[model samples]
Structure formats: structure tokens, C-alpha cells
Target: MKAYLILEDGSMYEGKSVGADKNVVSEIVFNTSMTGYLEVLTDPSYAGQAVVMTYPLIGNYGVCYDDKESNRPWVDAFIVRELSEFASNFRNEDSVQNLLKSNNIPCISGIDTRDLTKRLREYGTMNGMIVCESSFDMAQITQRINEYRVKGVVKKTSTEKIYTLPGNKKRVVLMDFGAKKSIAKELQKRGCEVIVVPYDTCAADIINLRPDGIMLSNGPGDPKENTAIIKEIKKLYDTDIPIFAICLGHQLMALATGADTYKLKYGHRGGNHPVKDLETGRTYISSQNHGYAVDESTLDKNVCVPAFINVNDSTNEGLRYINKNIFTVQYHPEASPGPGDSSYLFDKFMKMMED
Candidate 1:
């Protein structure tokens, strides 16, 4: 079936449909990763958005359930230049097209993805919809795009109840604001008893858990919209136990400490982002997927300082708190689909708990 990706700017690109025959609108962003399409599909951070794979060919390796970052896929739509219909990997289970159809995720293939990515980069990310219907009014589609907003995504993606991943060394309370499974896996690998909690879990309950450290997890959507969560994070800030945050967690903590976040022109979403550690003055390739970044000027100098920065645009990538064991990074250290260069940060967190 024929499908069209219609942008809010009235641009239309036609492609062959490769997913469920449904119309869906989303914030259209592009990722530059060469592989790991399976992880990108299941990542909760892509919630409320459509992902355009910049890589020309996708799904050659096939889908491995174990490589999924979340239990299910979160992307509203998937756009790519070419779609590999066959699976080739030894660990392959199902083909990508089948996965999309089963999950009701709309996908378009054989489109000029390079042109689409350039448009997103030139005009920033825009609202777009995939329409497989033979006939539809462009006026209504554009209207819907203008009215679309990514709201309440964190609640939708977060865990419904508390759970524990057993480990022997340190008791770490992981507040899941749409956290990836790899985050808990990383903590478990370090011999830490990981307690995963809901998005609305209060600081007092977490304190009652008698945790040696607190983990604020990565999530989706505008960070400022989470006023209540930010207040709870403020309370967590006062505690003596170590705290580590990633992506949205990093933004929320910065907001709790009087810093602000603004959306990037075209958010970083890929496996090969380079970040430089401020203290060490060394750069490392890091995987990242977020639209909002902490405003460095709004950061309270005495409360926290930048620990790392993006090499591409000099955006704040990490923070270190003054007189505290707390540290936060805007990029993923868990790196389920990216580089493991920054995985050592988790070890540092374990060391903080040990101290």
C-alpha cells in the first residue's frame, strides 16, 4: 500500500507502506546510528515521537528480543530509506516488518530519508503524520499537526508497580521515569540491589527504603511539565545519599536546583555523539536521545557544575554537585545501543556508595 509522510510545512513524501495501515502524527526526529534499529524501536525515550533512521538500510540483522531496551516498542512511527525484508543474524527471531505490524507501529520505506533528515535539521523537528488512506484533506492533517503535543508520555511509559532486581553490594533505589532495562542491568552488574519504583513515588517512601544511593532515570517529554516530580527530586537533593541522573533525570535535577532546559533545534538521537569530560579534558563517543538540554547559564554555580560537554555544539552533557556525591549526565552511560566509553560512570556511582 502507498503511504505518505506529510509534514506540517505542507511537504509530502510518498513511500511504500511497511507497517500497520494506520494514520499517526508525531514529533518527527531523525537518528544517525548505522545499526541498533531494534534498540531504537523499543527505547521508551522515543515515546510520543516518530523516528527517521538516517541510515539507508535497516533491519538487516533482524530483531532480537533480548536487545530491546523496553518490553515493547515506543515509537509512534518509523521512517527509513530502505527496508530489509529478510533476517540474517544468528540470533534473529522475527523480521522488522512483522514486528511493526504486530505492534501497530506505522512505518514507511523507500522514501528519501536523506532529504527528510535535512529538512528536519534545517527547520528543526516538525510535526508529521503517516497517512495510508488513498484520499485525505491536507488542511485537517496540518491542523492536527499544529495542535499536537507530547504530553503525559512519562506516566504512560513508566512502571505501574515497584519491583526489585536483586544484587548483593549496595542498595540503590531507581526511580523509573520511563527507564531503560539496561540501567537496572548495569546496576545489577555492579552488585547493587536495584529497587525500581514508579514515576510518582515520593521521596519519603524512597528514603524509607533505606537506600545507599538514588537513581533518577531518563524519560520523555518537556522536563518543565513535571512540576510535582521536580519537587520530589528537590527533597531527594537534601538527602546525604548519592544521586545519579541521566537525560530527562539530568534535566529534572537541574530544574530542581534552579536550572532551566530548552529544546534543541533538532535533538540529538543516535549512537555516535561525542562528549568531552571537563575535568579530564578527554572526549568519548556516547549514545544520546533527547530534545531538551540544560541551560548552562541557569545552573547555580555553588549547587552544581558542568562535568562534561558535547563536542558538536558544546551543550552541557554532565554535572557534578558541590560538596555532594551526586553526579548527572545528559547522555546514556548504560549505552544499550551505543558506545561503552562512558559506562565507567556507573562504577563511579558504586564507589560513591562504598565511600
Candidate 2:
């Protein structure tokens, strides 16, 4: 069936429907990763966005149940240049198209993804609609696109109740703002008892648990919009407990510390971004997926210092709080579907708790 990806700016790309035949309206963004399409699809951070895979060919390796970052795909829609006809991986359990269909997510294939990416790069990400109907009114579609906004995505994706994972070592309370499964997996692997809580959990309740440390998790949406959560995080910061955060959590931590954040032009959503450690002068390839970054100029120099920066864009990647056992990073250290170079940050957090 014929499908069309219509941008809010009136730009359209015609293609063939490869997944469910339903229509979808959401913010459209692009990912530069060549592999791990399944991981990207299931990542809760992409909750309100329709993802466009920049790497021409997708699903060549097929889907595996074990590779999922979440229980189900959260992306509103998927776009690809070409959908592979064959699933050839030894660990393959189901085809990509079948996965999307089962999740009721719509997808479009055989489109000029390169040109689409170029337009997004020049014009920035925009609200878009994926129309799979036989016939549709363009006027109505454009109206919906202009009125659409991605809000409350964190609450929609976060766990509603607190859950515990028993372990014999340190006790850590993980504030789950639509966290990836690997974040808890990494803590469990370190022998820590992980207690995953909802995003809106109060600091007093977390302190009552008497955890050895706290972990602020990654999630979706603009950081500045989470004003209530930021206030709660500031209360958490008042205590001396060690804290480690990633992605959205990083931005929130900065905001809690009197810093500000700004949206990037196109945002970084690739697995091969290079970040440099300011303290050691070492550079490492990191996996990133955020649209907003902490503004270094707005940070309080007396309270925190920039720890790491993106080499390509000179954006803040990591920060260290002075005289406090708190630190955060804007990239994924768990590396569920990317390189493991930054995985050592997890160990550093463990050491901080030990001290």
C-alpha cells in the first residue's frame, strides 16, 4: 500500500507501507546508527518521536527478543530507505515487519531517507504525519501536524509503581524516568540491590529507604519542562548520598543546580559520538540520544565543573559537583546497543558509593 510522510512544512515523501497500515502523527527525528534498529525502536526515550534510520538498509540481521531495551517498541513510527527482505541472523526469532505489526506501529520504506535527513539537518526536527490511507485530505493532515505537540511523554512511559531487584551488595534507589532495562541490569551486575521507583517519587521517601546511592535515569522530552521533578531532585541533592545520572537525568541535575538547558539544532541521536574527558584529556566513543543539552555557560562554577564535552559540537557531556558525591553524563554508559567505552563510569559510581 502507498504511504506518505508529510512534514508540517508541507514537504512530503512517498513510499510503500511496510508495517501496520494505520496512520501516525508525531515529531519526526533521525538516528544515525547503522545497526541496533530493534534497540532504537524499543528505547523509551524515543517515546514521542517517529524515528528515521539514516543507515540505508535495515533489519538485515532481524529481531531478537533478548536485544530489547524495553518490553515493547515505543516509537510512534519508523522510516527506512529500504527494508531488508531477508532475516539472516543466527539469533533471529522474528522479522522486523512482523515486530512492528505486532506492536501496531506504522512504518514506511523505499523512501529517499538521505534527502529526508538532509532536510531535517537544515530545517531541524519537525512535527510529521505518516499517512497510510488510500485517500486522505492534505488540509486536515496539515492542521493536525501544526497542532500536535510531544508532552507528558515521560509520565506516559515511566513505571507507575516502585519495584525491587534483590542483590547482596549496595542498595540503590533508581528514579525511573522511562529508564532503559540495561541501567538496572548494570547495577544488578555490580551486586547492587536495585529499587526502581516512579519518576515523581519524593526525595523524602527515597531517603527513608536508606540507600547507599541514587541513580537518576534517562527519559524523553524537554528537561526544562519537568519543573516539579527538578524541585524534587534539588531536595535529593541536599543530602550527602552519592548520585549518578545519565541523559535526561543529567539535564535535570544541572537544572537542579541552578544551570539551564537549551535544545540543539538537530540533536545528537547516534552511537558513534566522541566525548572528551576534561580531567584526563581522554576521548571515548559514546552512545547518545537527547535533543537538549545542559548550557555550560549557565552552570554555577562554584558548585560544579564540566567533566566531559562532545568533541564534535563542544557541548557539555559530563559534570562533577564540587565537594559533593554527585556526577552526571549526557550519554548512555550502559551501552545496551552501542560501544562500551563509557561503561567504566558505572564502576566510578560504584567506587563513589564505596567511599
Model number with the top TM-score: 1
Clashes per candidate, residues 3 or more apart or on different chains: 0, 0
Task: Write down the lDDT that model 1 would get.
Answer: 0.95
CA RMSD per model (angstroms): 0.6, 0.8
Q: After superposition, how far is residue 77 of candidate 2 from its true place, in Å?
A: 0.2
Tens-place lDDT digits, model 1, residues 39-126: 9999999999999999999999899899999999999999999999887999999999999999999999999999999999999999
Whole-model Cα lDDT of every candidate shown, in order: 0.95, 0.95
Candidate 1 backbone collisions, by pair = none
Which tens-of-lDDT digit does each residue in 108-214 have in candidate 2?
A: 99999999999999999999999998789999999999999889989988999999998999999999998999999999999999999999999999999999999
